[model samples]
Target: MTFKPLLAAALLATTAIAAPAFAGTKMKTEMSATPTSNIVETAVSVDALSTLVAAVQAADLAGALSADGPFTVFAPTNDAFGALPAGTVDTLLKPENKGTLSNILTSHVVAGSYDAASIIALAKANDGKAKLTTLSGAELKAYVKDGKVYVKDENGGKATVATADVQTSNGVVHVVTSVLLPK
Candidate 1:
């Protein structure tokens, strides 16, 4: 089978195993004051994003994410990482798995800073869904459902934006309820 199908299956399977039901609430990510740190630093500052921080470090993407070009990161929380099958994170963290880990991590990062409003508007303009290209060369569908913003992986697995428009010096961060896998 091709990697696209595999990625979709993996995402759906992982989500099915542990994702909690999202409360049907409107998306309300407020635009907070700009933070002085970059993406790495910003993510590190969040207690819930520790796993994502570790993965970024393990993937050796700290420097790139710290660079000048603004990026939009859909960061998964510790709980999201924990939702994966047992041993999944451990295996991905292995030194030999650096490439794979990097791909997975970069899949959550887009090239430019796309805030909540832009995403929502983009979706509304494009038939209720916007295709966002990630740094890993994957396409994620951004849409609004039940007044909440959600991102759908190529294979149809979805992640809710738990928080949005967290401004960092170099880019923006959106906390997501599940890890997004690339096709």
Candidate 2:
């Protein structure tokens, strides 16, 4: 056999063998490049929410909130729960209260995402008033006063967005100091 021919044959065989390895490497790389939403869903610590986190998990809404769609959640801090009538949190936590808790929690969530600036603009356009439809089928009124966002539920319960614009890959979170009770 000519040396040149042998060398060409050897090169062809090496190329063929490397093709599958290269393909496998490409697949691994693609798999590792997960979306930012997935990363945020995992890294974001809803654990700090304590009661609110537990309620979301109990209502089976953890996955929904973790989904790809952007959402703006007005999360109530633990102190907000304490402000409720005594035994209210305990009652809502019971298995029998799942539906009620789910409704109340979902009522805090609007269908689409909204940042503080957008919300303020909407409120201003509406002459310091804006109505937002919640996942619970209730209408929540939003207003801006003294440069702070405040939301009122059907029952006339109000919550001030104590902290606004907590950005996540999937959505934003605004911490509220009160629980909005729906009529």
Could you report the Cα RMSD, in angstroms, for every candidate shown? 11.2, 18.3
Q: What lDDT tens digits, residue by residue, belong to model 2 across residues 13-128?
A: 21111112112111110111012432124223333356787777667777777777677777787888889999999898888998999999988888677876677677778887
Check candidate 1 and list the clashing pairs: none
Give the range where candidate 2 is weakest over 10 consecutive residues by summed lDDT.
25-34
TM-score of each: 0.82, 0.74
Predicted candidate 1 versus true structure: per-residue lDDT over 21-122, tens digit per residue: 223432333223235567776565556777887888888898898899699998888999999899999999999999999998888999988887778778
| Model 1: residue 171 alpha-carbon error in angstroms | 0.9
The TM-score obtained by model 1 is: 0.82
What lDDT is obtained when candidate 1 is compared to the true structure? Answer: 0.75
Q: Which residue window of length 10 is worst by lDDT in model 1?
A: 10-19
